[model samples]
Target chain A: MYKLYEFFASGNCYKLRLLLTQLNIPFQRIEVNILKGESRTPEFLLKNPNGRTPVLEIETGKFLAESNAILFYLSEGTDFLPTDSFEKAQVLQWLFFEQYSHEPYIATSRFWITTGKAEENREALNQKRAGGVAALKVMEQHLTEHQFFVGDRYTIADIALFAYTHVADEGGFDLSKFPAIQAWIKRVQAQPKHISITQQV
Target chain B: MYKLYEFFASGNCYKLRLLLTQLNIPFQRIEVNILKGESRTPEFLLKNPNGRTPVLEIETGKFLAESNAILFYLSEGTDFLPTDSFEKAQVLQWLFFEQYSHEPYIATSRFWITTGKAEENREALNQKRAGGVAALKVMEQHLTEHQFFVGDRYTIADIALFAYTHVADEGGFDLSKFPAIQAWIKRVQAQPKHISITQQV
Candidate 1:
């Protein structure tokens, strides 16, 4: 059985949980409350040196960090990952974009606002708003032409992007203007075995 | 032949250039001077909606963006990428860490300083310093245990990380303390057909 070290409300963690559930892979969920600095503990650091949530213990001693990488690992040879080389790379393209371009702004802003740090980090939040909007605009443009992020099918790419994007409103991003993204969100939710971010497996 | 749209100095662009050269694959390098906002132009935006350099034209009208994704695409069948499932995912784990945990701090600081925006972004620079140092510390700890990022061999993970880390000093990061990383830098440079960041094909 896989042991997932995660924070429940975290979109990064939710990416893994949603995928695992959809794939019908059973796993043990161990909540590491990032708000309490539990991830920074020395023992947890052994599992992941970066001290972040969503570490998947593939076995008792072996582990994998990075939400997208974990998704890639678990989805291999399954329908969630495409077999074509180009399509696989395309899936990775969006995954990287989510980590570098999308998650930092959209997810972090939501974290700050929801964790009650918005007032203290107002300037940083202001700086992040533009980036969040830009990411959404990119998604909106892509979603306008395609049904899913890759190959017109619901893949882990959709799961990866949808985790935070569905909750971007909590980050103070106005998704009302991005009708394409709004429509795509509904498409993602309609997938088989779909689960919300807050759902416990 | 692949056509790489790139800015010469960028670590992201260098990753692809280094891999293409090492793999003995011929490619056309189309310089997109991001410093002058060339990447954001209407023409370039058609190549990559993200408006970023290091977009790989795999063939006519088929483009792939994100440097690590390009590396994964090109290195797929080669020894540059491991064939084993677990090792492949480990390579991706480092790639994600590079983009998320490492690049934002290490690479962005280098960009701000090298592009003469450090003075204006001093507050931001100060903020980034801690993150850069922390990333290096993580590298130091990992490199101490492994010769390469995964499978005890050089892979795209090294290429992805080497792009920024070798020039981290330009970002005002002190590398003297990370002896393991310094040694690993030399190891990466010693790879067969290795090319410097400034070297044009």
Candidate 2:
């Protein structure tokens, strides 16, 4: 059996949990409350010196952190990772997009809004919210014709982006503005073995 | 032929250049000067919407961004990526470590210190420098025993970590404190096809 150390609300963690369910892989879930600073404790830091969440622990007790990286780890040699060279690179491209362009804006806005800290830095939060919308719009434009993120199939790329994008509403970004993204989300949820983010493995 | 779009001084770009040399993979280097804001132009953004480097343009003209992602792409189905399941995960583990823990601290501190922006944020820069050194110390501990980042072999894990760890001194973290890392650097450099970051493709 494997173990997943995660925060309930994290899209990064949720991405991995969703993959586990879709793959029918059995794993124990250990909740690390980031709001309570559980990740900073010596015990947790020993597992991942970076002090972040969504670490996957294998049966041998070795811990792997970073949600996208864990998704790669689990998806290797599977259909989730495209076998074609170009398609594979495309997967990596979108994963990188989710990190640099998308996460910085979208995740930050979600953090500020959901935690109700947006009032403290209203101007900055607003700017971030706008940027988040911009990123979502990029996805919306792409999703208009494509059923999934990279290829014509469901992949970790979709899982990676969907984790945060689906929750963009919590960050005060209006999802209704992007009908393509709305349709794409429904398409993803319609997949077999799909699991909700809050569900336990 | 493969082409790499990169900035002259970016470690992210340098990582790919380093790997290409080691693998004897011929590539044309296209320099995108970041200081002049070349990455923001519409033409560059079309290649990579995130507008960062290094973007590896395959023979098909499809571009790929994100340094770690590019590393994974080029190294796939090759010896640079580990074949074993757990070893492959370990490679990803360190790649993620480089991104989350090492890059935020080490790369940022280096940018501030080397580029002489430390005066503008001396206190904050000092705090970051300390954090960067702490990360280096963690690497020192790991390198003290392991020959490479994983499985006693030179994989992309070493390539990813070495890109920054070798030049961490530019970040204001004294490398002399970590003799094991120095030894590890020498080990990586001693490899048959290893190339210095200064030497461009």
Candidate 3:
């Protein structure tokens, strides 16, 4: 049976849980609270030296980390990942962009704010917000030209991006300025069997 | 023909060029100097709105960015990328770690230092160096146990991490402590048909 080691509030974990639900795949979710230092425990480190959550125990003793990697693993050979080579590569590009450009700014801000640590991280947040805005602008431009991130269809690319993007506002990002991204959010939400960011099952 | 728009100093660009050469995949490399703001030009923006180098034009007028994604595309069918589903996912995990954890810290420091911008960005470099060291510590821990990043085989995961890691000293990181990583670098370089990171062919 599949098992997921995750923190409920994490977008990285959410991305994996959301896809598993969308695909109607059954799995068990075990909470690994980062704030409490659960992920850094020696046992957890054995599973993932990186000490991050959303680790998928694909089978007994075999595990995978990195939410996008987990998403790709579960979605491959299914409609969620494209069969065409170029489209597949495009999906990967957006996943990398989400982690590097989008998440660092948007997700981290949300984490700091949600946990009441914003005051201590104000300067960092200000810098991150600027980056967050730039990332939103990039997404806005892309969504204006294409309905979806890759192949003009709802795939894991949209799933990977949708994780933190729909909730970027909680990170102090003003989404109203990004009309295209706003519309794309609605399109992704409209997909069949879609689950909310924090939902499980 | 495949055309790679890249900056010679960029580890991201080098990841693709290294893999293509290792796989005996013929491709054209066009240098885009980030120092002169060439990648930011209107013409280059048409290729990648993100304005980053190491964009792979897989075919005429069609492009893909994000270096790890490009590596995945070129190496999928070859031995560089594993055919097994689980092994492939493991490779993706490392690729994401390289970009998010390793590259930002290591590659950015190398850029600031190499460009003589470290003095102006002292605080940023110091912060980046700490992160770079932490990332190296993680890799050192991993390599201490496994010879390769995944399946105990040489794969694109090695190439992706090697791009920035082999030169991390340029970022003021002391690699003398990461004995395992130092050895892994030699293993990757010893691969058949392997090319130095900055080589064009």
Per-model CA lDDT versus the true structure = 0.94, 0.83, 0.91
Q: Candidate 2, residue A126: CA error in Å?
A: 5.9
TM-score of model 2 vs. true structure: 0.89
Per the 3 Å backbone cut-off, how many clashing residue pairs does candidate 2 have? 0
| Best-fitting candidate, scored by DockQ | 1
lDDT of 3 at A53: 90
Candidate 3 C-alpha lDDT tens digits along A22-141: 899998989999999999999999898888998999888888999999999999999999999989999999999999999999999999999999999999899897788888988999
lDDT of 3 by residue, B100-169 (tens): 9899999999999999999998998888877788889899998999999988999999999999999998
| All candidates in order of DockQ, best leading | 1, 3, 2
In model 3, what lDDT does residue A150 have?
92
Model 1 misplaced regions, further than 4 Å: none
Tens digits of per-residue lDDT, candidate 2, A41-67, equal 999988877788988888656888778
Model 1 lDDT per residue over A1-201, tens place? 999999999999999989899889999999999999999999999999999989999999899999999999999999999999999999999999999889999999999999999999999999998888889999999999999999999899999999999999999998999999999999999988999887768
- The number of the candidate with the highest TM-score is 1
Q: Residue by residue across B1-201, what tens digits does model 1's lDDT show? A: 899999998999999999999999999999999978999998998888888888999899999999999999999999999999989999999999999999999999999999999999999999998888988999999999999899999999999999999999999988899999999999999999999998868
What is candidate 3's CAPRI-style docking category based on DockQ?
A: high
Of the true interface contacts, each candidate retains a share of: 0.87, 0.53, 0.89
Scanning candidate 2 chain A in windows of ten residues, the lowest lDDT window is A121-130
Clashing pairs in 2: none
Task: Report the lDDT tens digits of candidate 2 across residue range B33-128.
Answer: 877789878899878766577888886657877898889888988888987877877787788677766887888787777777889968767767
How would you order the candidates by TM-score, starting with the best?
1, 3, 2
